[model samples]
Target: MNNEVNGDGPDSCGIRILGETRDLTVVNNRIGNAPKGQQHIGILIGEKSDRIELRENELSGNLDRKIEDRREEKLWPVQIRR
Candidate 1:
């Protein structure tokens, strides 16, 4: 599946994960566009989220952030493997 979000505001992204999400896995996906002065985000992992796995995914050209994590945990709970 293809996910796309076009906005020039905060929290605008291809994928937005909020609240208490755990044990989530994203694999083999193409996210966002190649930056050409456009502000975009590949994914937004918000507060109270944990244990997210990103594997074999192509996230490119997000001028803002490829992965933005806003969790309040002491340690980052994202595992990325490519």
Candidate 2:
């Protein structure tokens, strides 16, 4: 199966994390195939969010991908592996 997201603006990503969310893991998934004219992302970690883990995942065929800590503070660690 193909994972798709057809939309614009914030939270219109294949994976999204926001607020004070932390200690989370996103692993072993196939994320792709966004609509032709939309703002889609491979992964997104929003403002004030931290400690996110993205491991052994495949991200392709998308629009925009801004994957990281949006905030300047990180108490733990974020891991992204393939």
Candidate 3:
């Protein structure tokens, strides 16, 4: 596992992986502008986790509008069930 997270506060979240288990590798990090209360996820994989690999990371300006109004009122109608 390799990790490097550069920050620009506002409750920075360059990486957040939760639960379960698997092979993991996250490389080359530069995540920016991630704050808007609670869970600010530049990378948050938490649906009972699985094999994970995020490489060559360079995520910029999370475009925080209170995190898009709390992810449009809690991730509404967005279906992408693995």
Candidate ranking under lDDT, highest first, comes to 1, 2, 3
Collision count for each candidate, in order? 1, 0, 0
Indicate whether candidate 1 or candidate 3 has the larger lDDT: 1
Answer with 1 or 2, whichever has the higher TM-score: 1
Model 2 misplaced regions, further than 4 Å:
4-6, 66-68, 75-77
lDDT of each: 0.75, 0.68, 0.47
Candidate 3 on 9-61: residue-level lDDT in tens? 54445566556534566677765553434334566555555556666766556
Instruction: Candidate 1: list runs displaced more than 4 Å.
Output: 1-3, 34-39, 74-76
Model 3 C-alpha lDDT versus the unseen true structure? 0.47
For model 1, residues 1-82, the per-residue Cα lDDT tens digits are 2344466675567778887888899999888765443446778888888889999988776447899888877365699999
- lDDT-wise, the better of 2 and 3 is 2
TM match of model 2 to true structure:
0.74
State which candidate has the highest TM-score. 1
- Assess candidate 1 and give its lDDT: 0.75
Estimate, for each residue in 17-71, the C-alpha lDDT of model 2 and write its tens digit.
Answer: 8778878888898776546445456677777777788898877765566463566
- Which ranges of candidate 3 are over 4 A from the true structure? 1-31, 34-39, 59-82
Error of 1 at 67 (Å): 0.5
